[model samples]
Target: MNLKNKIVTVIGLGNSGVNAANLLSDAGAVVRATDSQDTPATREAQAALEKRNIKVEIGGHTENFIKGSRLIVVSPGVKESSVALQWAKEHHITIISELELGFRFSKGRIIAVTGTNGKSTVTTLIGEILKSGGKDTVVCGNIGNSLCQEIARIKDDTWVVIEVSSFQLERIEKFRPEIALILNITDDHMDRYNNFNDYFSVKSKIFRNQTADDILILNYDAPYLRDLKKKTRSNVIFYSKKEGSSDAYVKDGWVTCVSEGKIRRIARISDIRLKGAHNLENVLASAIAGLRAGVREDSIGRTVKNFIGLEHRFETVDTIDGVEYVDDSKGTTVDSTCRALESCDRPVILIAGGRDKLSDYTVIRGILRERVRQVILIGEAKERIRSSLDGTVESIFADTMPQAVELAGRFAKGGEIVLLSPMCSSFDMFRDYKHRGEVFKEAVKKLKTRRVPI
Candidate 1:
């Protein structure tokens, strides 16, 4: 772990990569960073890194720069197929993920959360529970700031709750969470991976380094995850919606946990503030992690009762002429959108389709036919979604977010819902999911003053 005067190359100059570069330089490494993008953000990052005397290259990568580095640190956004990474692999350079780099420098016990969905919610909630229990906690990784950004502040007793993606787990050598939670695995990031099993295998790496002393919390309900405990060395804790055979389960209308042969009630089903059954699963997983971390049962219950959830995931934007507009722009996969559709009690005018993830659009047909009255398609995968949902619901195309909002308002009647739950990634039309959610919200705000047919 001694980095003094060691050569290191960081791939991708995004938030994680920038932080990784600065951290490496601070650790006395001869840091060299590269990013394929040369946008304003990367330019700013480049200026900051140069000030620290870290050599940086943006707009493209060079094989020579990568070849000279003895070690390579990769940000999650950098693809495995990246030329620099491929070159490093070919040359037998030691490569690791940004998550692994941060883990090596971290002085805290980590509670890492990963899954296709609900990772942010569960990760943040665990931090809240630990904080309420009076534990020093820092929440970072995929949800908020990069883990490397918070590394210097974390102490030996600090509880680091990180939301890890499959990409972050790909290059780990010794990164292991003290408490690991995989919410559930479903169809996601299909384009980045060769197939579904490839994505699933990467996510399983989160616990590959965990030992018998560590805890691995998994969803007992997800068929793909039910038997995953056998693959890990960590002590497995199963959270389930069912009544029996789980460490955390719902029974007699209360969320209960069986710990040390004693049944502890965490919260009532009606007491959870977050909407959706998926969120209930998140709370269950968080509760188990909290108990394992020695968080008081009362603290766990209190946090779940008050946690309303993060923005852009089932957030009620506004009601225009009684037609409620909801923002679920964070739904970036077919499975997540189906869950969103399931959560809606009213008929929906669904705004979907973004950058395609190679998800099978037809899997959402049953939910669309059940709850959705219309589908407004946008982004690169609009035509594919339209074709997949052809017989299930009436589908239309909108050129922009505002147009989509207008079209939904025109077609939606009072008591109906206009839900922005894109079943694909947001990269096609927006900077990220947050940006996509903001645009959807702003469009809804603008539509409030315009009178539409009820």
Candidate 2:
């Protein structure tokens, strides 16, 4: 793992790529960073890399640089079909993800969480539980800060809780976590993957390098994970909302964990602040990981009670004229949007549609027909969504977020909810999900100023 004098090329120049380049440069490796687009963020990242004496190639990628390097580190955003990556493969150059690079140098034991949804919530909760138990914890990856950036801060006793994505998992070689949790995998990232099985295979790699001494937390109810006991050598632990054979499950209104014949109450269902059954699954998974990390049950329970949930994931914007507005911009997949729809108690005027992930929107047809009053569509997938939900629910097309909000507000009745739970990625319009959520909130604020009639 000695990087001194080694030639390294980092692709995509995003946060993770820049961090990887800087890390390699700091370790005396010759680093070259590349990206296709010269965005403001890319420029800032370029400047940082330049300050570290790392070479940067922006606006486009060069295959020669990647092929000639001793190693290539790819950002999660970089696709497998990239010409430079293809060249690197043909040349037999060692290519690894930023996460893998970080793991090679990280001093702490890793707790990695991966799923189509709920990775952030579960990862954050695990970090909180460990911290509450007076353990030094660092939470990173996919959620925001790159693991490579956090590598320098890792100490022997530190607990590194990571939120991993399938994209990052695809390129990992030996990035095995001491504790791995696969919350639940559904049809997601279909645009990137050829099919559902292809996506699942990539995600299942999180357990590939795990040994019998390591632990894997799985969803007992998810059919995909139920029979995966023989897939890895790790000791598998199960968490379920239903009363089933699992390490963690709700029993008599309390979430309990049973490991090695020892039973412990993690938290009461009424104590968790996060809404929805999906969140209950998240809590259960986190609690199991927390307990395995030696966190006290009281510490885990207290963290769950105080955890208010993440932004853009069922966050309440404001109520205007007895109508509630919820921003679930993180609901970028059909399964995630279905969870959001199911969580709402009141009738919904749903604002949905964005860049389609090749998702089957019909999966949520039953919920839409039963609960949603109307579906206001926006972005690239609007027509696809409208077509799939044409007879199931009333659908309207809007060109912008403001228009969508206004239209939803107009149709919303008193005690109704105007929810922005687009079942596709926000890349069709905004920079990402966070920007999309912010714009939706701003639109809601504008509605208040207009005094729009309900």
Candidate 3:
């Protein structure tokens, strides 16, 4: 990773890309960053990096900016089909993700979490558990902070809990974590990958370099991930809601670990604050990682008890006129939205649809029919979603998030749930899932006193 005045090209100029360029420049590399976007944000990023003497290309990438001497580092948002990557491949230049670059310089053992869903929750939980157990910890990566941004804070004793994504895993070369947890792999990011198998293969690369000493925690319910045990040399551990079938599992309302015929209780199911089976799975995975990292059962239990779930993922905004409005804007894939629905306690007036991820909307038809009282669709995927799920339930469309929320208010009645669980990415109508969730909350707030009979 010694750049030492060697030219390094950074493709994409988002937060991670900017951090990568800064990291390379600080490591004494001559860094040049490029992004096709020329927005105000990119210009601001460009201004900040230019002070560090890092060359930045904003409007578009040209051959002059890309024909480099040493290596290429890419941000997760950039496509592998881009001309810059094509050139890198054509010239046989070495390529790696910013995650890989960060790992090359990082000290301490890492706990990396990757899956179609629940990565952020599990990563945060593991970090909390380790810290509570008297271990130095820093949580970074796809849970809003890039590893390069936290390099100065990472120490040799630091337990690095990273929330990794399929995009980040695609270009990793030697980024191996001591504890690698795959929560679950469902069809996701279909827009980026050729198929589900391609996405699955890329995610499996997280443990590709791990030795037998490293541990790979998996979900026993995820059937597709079972074959992964045969693909890796790492020590494998599976977590399940059922008892006795996995290294870590829930038995008789308690979270327990079974190893070498030994059973150790970690936490009671009643102590957990997070709802839903998906979240319970997240807790089980985090507990195993914590115990493996030397966390005591009491410490793990306390952390799990106090750990509230992440925002924009099944967060209850407010109860208006006996209707509960839940925001799950982070459920950006069909599988995630289905999990959210499966966790709901009341009949739902589901608000969904966004930038389509090319997911099969019909896969969710069964859940929609069972749990959802009505479906209010919005954003670019609304029409396609309605088409796929036409006869499953009562369906309608709205052009915006506010409009969708307003419609939900009219259709929802007492003892019913109004859940904003868009099964597609939020690029079509908002900045990100957070913004979409915020808009939905605000819309819900406006309807506190206004209620209509369904």
TM-scores vs. true structure, each candidate? 0.98, 0.97, 0.98
Expressed as tens digits, the lDDT of each residue in 1-454 for candidate 1 is 7988999999999999999998998899999999988999999999999999999999998889899788999999888789998999889999999999999999999999999999988988999999999999999999989989998899999999999999899999999899999888988888899998999999999999889999999899997897887888899989899977689998998999987788999999898889888888988999989999998788899999999999999999988788899999999989889889889999999999899988989999988889999899999999988888878888999999999999999999999999999988898899999999999999998888666546
Error of 3 at 123 (Å): 0.7
Clashing pairs in 1: none
Off by over 4 Å in 2: 452-454
Q: In model 2, which range of ten residues has the least summed lDDT?
A: 59-68
For candidate 3, what is the TM-score?
Answer: 0.98
Please tell me which predicted candidate would have the highest lDDT against the true structure. Answer: 1
lDDT of 3 by residue, 209-269 (tens): 9999999998988888888899899999999888755888888899898644668888888
Q: Which order, best to worst by lDDT?
A: 1, 2, 3
Error of 3 at 114 (Å): 0.2
**lDDT for model 3:** 0.90
1-454 per-residue lDDT for model 2 (tens digits): 8989989999988889888888888888989988989889889888988888888888887777776789999999999989888889889999999999999989999999999999988888889899999999999999989999998889999999999999999889999899999988999988899998999999999999999999999999898798889778999998898777898999999989986578999778888789899999999999889989988888888898899999999999999999999999999989999999889999999999999988999899999988899889999999888888878988889999999999998999999999999999999899999999999999999999999666
